[model samples]
Target: MLVMHTPPQHHIVILGAGFGGLRTALELEKRRARLKDFHVTLIDKRSEHVYTPLLYEVSTGALHDNQKFCVGELCSGVAVPLEAYPQAMRSKRLTFKRGEVTGIDPKKKEVHLKDGTRISYDDLVVALGSAVSTFGIPGVNEHALFMKCLADAFRVRQRLAEFLGAYVEGKEKRVEIVVGGAGPTGTETAAELGNFFDRLVKNGIIKRKDYEIRLVEAAPDILGIYPEKFRVHARARLETIGVILMTNTKILEVKKKQVVTDKGEINADVMIWSGGIRPLDVVKTFGLALDEKGWIPVEPSVLVKGQKDIWAIGDVAAFLDPKTGKRVPALAQATTKEASVVAENVTRRLERKRPMAFHPPSHWVTAIPLGGAYGLVDFGSWSLRGRLGYFVRKAADFFYFFSILPFGQAFRMWLKGTNVYIKND
Candidate 1:
């Protein structure tokens, strides 16, 4: 007589369809085919995932269609159906549920959704992500536009279009666009807007003297997290494209038509906020162990502290870098890397094996596109700028796309018409 053993099925619930959660589910789906004991369920509010890295480009006319950026279509372009992935095709246990996650009960291992339904899980992955932080600045939330989502990007394009149209029609003599914060999002957006205006002026649509672009930072210098060499290089590039740098100037308030700063007031037609971020509201209420900043504390295995089966990844999770003594950044690169670690650890635990610890990289790469066909790239010790840097950034964008999309689709989309640079007349 021969005896056989059957593996027990496990219910895995992943919250949020952002990069970290989605990647973890996909990675687990691959392993479940062999393990044959786990069913994965992914939940999110939106139907599509927004590719945030390209949002600045979409906001500017440089990457648009029909003279505007379509918020719905832009999100749909990047959003792939969670159920349509190859792993999902082979695994009937993989599924996607569209709903807003309201709360969680760790004692019962149940997740509550706004729809009044409850989901139970043997293992849970909480990649709830982060939200924009206005820092309680007076009039910011009410007046200033954000650049966090596809909808925000679309609103930016629409507002810019209206402002520029008025300027061209002679109703406005000067148009000023102020971008608050000197981080990558702010700097890139400022430079892109400068390039857009330069094209309009060269094409005789608007006079070069009729518009002003400002990049404001409360910090002493822009790109402060980067090396001094890269920061100076980035600053010079912005200046070359006619963006006025306002460093060490804090914003006091945002009025109806102007912004009051510590130094002076800026007359503005548009204002964009890309200042900082905080964990989502749900994360704050989840009762997870969080740091003073309210981000979930996670162990080196990417598991939420004090929780055996719950893992937290992405912006909502804070893992301190032992080497730098700083929390890992909320960049897309970090999200993907952390997702991989969590996925592996989850599998190892299922097999009764010791979970592996995550090691932060010694150094990271930074590639930024200034504006037009110009940009900068820093590869740890080495650096490059100008056209070469621009191409390098494009290559990195394509590489990320490749990781998420089918090869043919990624290649075609990367080379799409939206990416083509229009020559300035």
Candidate 2:
């Protein structure tokens, strides 16, 4: 006798557990009782979810001693009802049982996992996010360390700690730290390391003159995304903290212990590459309409062109800017806003209503922590510096991470933040 398995009723499958995916899942749950019709399945390769914006602090040892647990606990509240399955998105209903995404079929909407299990989804949401893009630069992937995840942050911290230990042990050893690209990640990492080195110096672990820190960028100046005045202020602040600024230098190659650039070669004990980001490789497997750079081309509504029932957000989605006619930068603010729109659109689709249009916000705020208790804040037209800027930056950071959680949970996080240094010590 032949038998057919009945599919589970009210299924909603969300791929990735990043900001976009997590937010979408939460919003769906918020409307779950009203909709009364969908089982949500949240899939990610890793069990832990991290707040990427504050990852640099983790690397500097300013956040937590145990970085592993910090990331896993960030999403503990949301993981309950969403069923956080540690799996990769291979296809529509098919996923790699373990942590690998082997194959996907967009046409038939089937995913094939490495362990030979398949899953079919009634409704699919892909928010797999982007990965560190090497930009076809040779030796980059093999040599330069990335700060994309908790593991990456931990690895960088471990390396930094080891380097410090070695420097303290051997007086003659000269350690050079090279940070490539002067974007927010690179800038923040440089600043945090500067503070860490300052702390080491103050603690007599190492002399201030023992370490050499270099911030390199191909652009004319650091903080290229921000206005020129803000860039000037940031550069000045970084220089004051002993970071050697090297602008207008293009990296030709990244060697095992050195970087070859248009200007010259610099030997480095630690190399961090925060140059740019590319779309996730899995996006290619979906066979969706993509731009020349492999980013999914989407309409104003954040829907993938030529692909119905599919949506893209975050760094992976390439939606044209109505004003500049250029692609928007893949910032956390952009991703979070896009997530809300995606969730609302999905709800509209279920109700057979028109989807809302995606509009880039007019004003955006960027807070960049220089080191320890100093930073720069840019509110489009206005900019703040020094202690005031630092206060705003810290407040913004707290708000951004805390607001994502429930009210009580947010309050707990606030309390934890207030006493994080004491507890860690």
Candidate 3:
């Protein structure tokens, strides 16, 4: 006699709970009525889904609840619980399991969890997101601060607080904050730190020259991908606020109190590494071939190449643009859109309908918060700057919150974020 094992058996098992994964889970459940008896299981190690766009604020201490902030309210308010999904609560079809994926056996269609439990699936959606890439720079993994997740945000906040406090109390001669990387993360963190330092000056805590920030980038120019207009505006504003632009300066190594660069060594009371992101190691366990960048190659419809029922999306997927033949940048908009495409494709496949090809936007909007009160929003056709641009950026945050949360909860979360982060401006 043969016996079938129980899954909490699911037909579709989505991995990771980031924007791509969480949205995929909820959207699939919305169409649960079509799947008949088949169920969807979404698994992740963490309980909360981090909204990364606001993590810069967290690092700058804007998300602090009070003197005790330390990314408390923002972590909870910005990152909603996985169990908070209304669909998962109401439907038996959608299930959220909190577990870390250890390995995957593609031949058996099974996912092995950290706790030694195995889950078999007919179709698998891999949305495991990216991690900060040290790029093998010496001492970066040991001495530099990262801004990838909530825990990183908290570490940055606490470490900055300790260093800044030391400077304020006259225990340190001066503060030197070096942001390594000229990308959005590095630029934003440096610009926001300028505002925080200015506030300290206004409050008589530190002199104007007591603390300095240097933004180092190996690239020739900052915001290299943004249009000339946005880049010019951001560079100008950052300089006006005393953030030293060190473009074309390559970071060679990180020391305890200094950064060794191709140009010269610079003192670093705090070093923030916003260099880049890479796919997690878990992707390798799936027994799938990855592109040169360690991201899986997928069809235009996002089905993994050479894999029968495995689909890849978000940072883990090397989704290409038909026009440019370049992989889509791991922007938030593209990630969320990938969620919709994957959700629809999977549901349609289950319904015996053909999957649709994904056509992402030709130009992705770029939002750079220049400082506490100022921002630059580049819409490709036109752009906004100053207070208006900042408001637009904040509006995007609210829009994202509303998209994922119920109205009341979203409103409360938005209110909290706005209240805490407004002072950042």
Candidate 4:
């Protein structure tokens, strides 16, 4: 008589709890009933997952409607705790580990943590996101502030508040803010800061002529990736709010109290960099096939080139979109969709089934808030401006938090009733 033995369980480890990693975990949870002997462990340096879209809002102190919320308050609730997944804990198949990843040994299929612990895996998913890239610019690393994480937003707010206090107390004559990049991050931040300063002037906290905000861009036009109409609208909106545009200007170096540009020099009290991002250093340690730009190159199926058991997603993965014939932009929509493909592929591979290729939308729809009650929306050729766009942006934000947060918490956050907002008398 022949006896049958169950094969050893496949241990799957995912690094980073950003959109890609979190969505992958949710997808795998649904397969708990079918995929026996399947284990998934998610690892993130920080236990909380940040909602990155609202980052600029926090920086500008416009994260609330009727009330005010501190930067820390906004970020504290926006970040969902990775370990708060009751469903995952109940299934006994998914677990969350908090630790910074030091390196990856592909030969041994192991991940080394900074805390001196090692995790072995049969399959690995790399979603560790990118960080601000200074492009070897002198003084950029030492002087400029970044807007990449929750902590960054808080720091910016703190500095702005300090500057405002100094100006109101007659210590400083003027406040000059210089923003670099002119992409969505830069545009949104500039708009928010302008609006915040306008409010200060209205409330008599500061004089109108006390602050000067400049947005510097290396490109000829701002929001260059968007349609021409949207770009025009964005420029007009920003100009109306008194944000000076320095197009086709490149920053040579950031100094202690000023930024030197190729065009000239501008004295500034604050310099925020939204310039660009590059893949994290740990990505190279995975021994994966990287593109010329040093980003992990993956197929439409989200599989690392030439490797079956290893996959890459999120900002770290460089995938050429077949429909558009361009590299997919690192957006929340792209990351979430890629995560689904990766999860499905992993399930199919484990069940001895063929994997499916990822098919992204040919065009993406996006809304850019222009501070206060104004925003702009772009859906291919069509566009919407003003309050309508603002509501749409709010609804989109609502759906995102709703999908990720508990029902009650999502409701409060969406309705302006969240404790995140502080009521000022």
Compute each candidate's TM-score over C-alphas.
Answer: 0.92, 0.87, 0.94, 0.93
| Candidate 2: tens digits of C-alpha lDDT, residues 121-187 | 5556677788897777788899988888877877887787677556656834767889999999999
Which residue ranges in model 1 land beyond 4 Å of their true spot?
Answer: 1-7, 62-91, 417-425
In order of lDDT, best first, we have 3, 4, 1, 2
Q: Which numbered prediction scores highest in TM-score against the true structure?
A: 3
Instruction: Please report the candidate that would top lDDT against the real structure.
Output: 3
Report the Cα lDDT for residue 357, model 1: 86
Residue-pair clashes, model 3: 2
**Regions more than 4 Å wrong, model 4:** 1-7, 62-72, 86-91, 416-425
Better of 2 and 4 by lDDT: 4
Which pairs of residues collide in model 2? 10-39, 93-119, 93-120, 94-111, 94-119, 96-113
Give the whole-model CA lDDT for all candidates, comma-separated. 0.79, 0.71, 0.83, 0.81
Model 3 per-residue lDDT tens digits across residues 138-204: 9999899988888887788888778766775778868899999989988988898887777777767
The TM-score of candidate 1 is 0.92
Give lDDT: candidate 3, residue 17.
91
